[model samples]
Target: MATRGTQILNPRTGQRSVFLQTAQDTGGALFQMETFHPAHNAAEPEHTHPFQESRCQVLTGTLRFRVGGVERTVKPGEAIVIPPGVAHHFWNDGEVEAHAIQEFRPALNIEDFFVAYFALARDGKLSDGGIPKSVLQLAVLLKAYDRVLRPTNPPRFLQRVLMETLGPVGRLAGYRPDYI
Candidate 1:
């Protein structure tokens, strides 16, 4: 379980996530976090969660969210809910920093994903945009959290096939699932 106030920086999108409520604190019901996104940061790639829903409330600056083909700019105090299996992504579109609170239902291992990903960034194993430098590394990381992140582009079938084929190769190359 993540401790309260635990913070992680995602190098790829220039967002800092500070955990507020963790799965353990809520008995596995939910996870809540406060995120600070730098101005004009890149958007998270459109993705779907197979078993979790998410809610986001903008606290400051401007945020743009695209959910299920609908795009909206959320200002301070505005909020949005993303249903499970719906394709969604977000970006900081304001001239200043954007602060938002995000909550995930049925917590899952989303927190762990952040920890591992950020650890990779700290170790210089990721690109400037936060993507793993190696294809095998990306495969291993994504395969470990397949249930939580399903990219919407390039078709799900192709993504699955590629991941499935690469997962073993990544493992054989000594990629472990956890970074910390």
Candidate 2:
């Protein structure tokens, strides 16, 4: 684990990511961070987490959220909480790139996923449109997340469509996290 006294650094990739363990003195417990995806989209599904709950705050662009059997729209500066074990999915519903702060409980190994994705993305390891393939492996990896975190995405078919179809287009459309 990174020491709490360590200083965090920002990457040129456009993210201000930091480790909460470094903030233990500040009463940090939840995994929190702001993310900006330059023209990104989701291959997400209506799913739930077994233990984790998350919140999304739209800082820019339109964030379309579907959760708990209801669909809601969140604009800039707006937020929504997704309780654990409720079906949910979302996407950037705007012309410009989107920005949002995603807060997750227990700081679930979610950051590990992004770290891997960005590493691959940096090396052009993703498939057509930066997805690594029309079929996103990330979604597949996330499917197993059901055993660890609260279910957040939906079914595999729906996830396939969102990740393979929608996610690819977003990546091809210049959906680079740091670029936004």
Candidate 3:
């Protein structure tokens, strides 16, 4: 479980996150963090939280977001709300680092996902695109965190099928839900 001040750095993506309110801290109602995104960083993979809505308020620099296929630039002090199940991606396009406060409602294990994902990224277990290098491990992680995040590509039904078929095998191979 993450706590207030818990910090994670994803070198691959040049993003740093500091937890301010964790799931445990709020009895699972909310998760909030401060993010320092590197300038010129690539946009994140388009993904959606199946059951959680998210809000982001920029603190410094600028962020470019593509929410539901509409792209927009967000300046300091500007905020954006992404409804549950809406595909979205963001990147820092300014010359300086971008800082933002991010919040998620009905947290639903998102902190756990960040802990594991960042650990994997730090240890070089993930690819340049932030995916696990091992297919089995990817399947296990995706299956376990399906409620918190789902990739927009490949369709939901196909992902469900792949996870169901490979998740068990991954577990049998000693891969756990938390990569760490």
Best by TM-score: 3
Best first by TM-score, ranked? 3, 1, 2
lDDT of 2 by residue, 70-152 (tens): 87778888999987767777666557766777777765555554455555555655544334442444444444343334333
What candidate 3 gets wrong by more than 4 Å, as runs, is none
Candidate 3: worst-modelled 10 consecutive residues by lDDT: 153-162
Off by over 4 Å in 2: 1-28, 117-180
Give the Å error, residue 120, model 3. 1.4
The TM-score that candidate 2 achieves is 0.55
lDDT of each: 0.84, 0.55, 0.90
Q: In candidate 1, residue 101 scores what lDDT?
A: 95
For every candidate, C-alpha RMSD to the true structure in Å: 1.9, 9.1, 1.0
The per-prediction tally of clashing pairs is 1, 21, 0
Q: lDDT of candidate 3 vs native?
A: 0.90
**Clashes, model 2:** 21
Summed over model 3, clashes come to 0
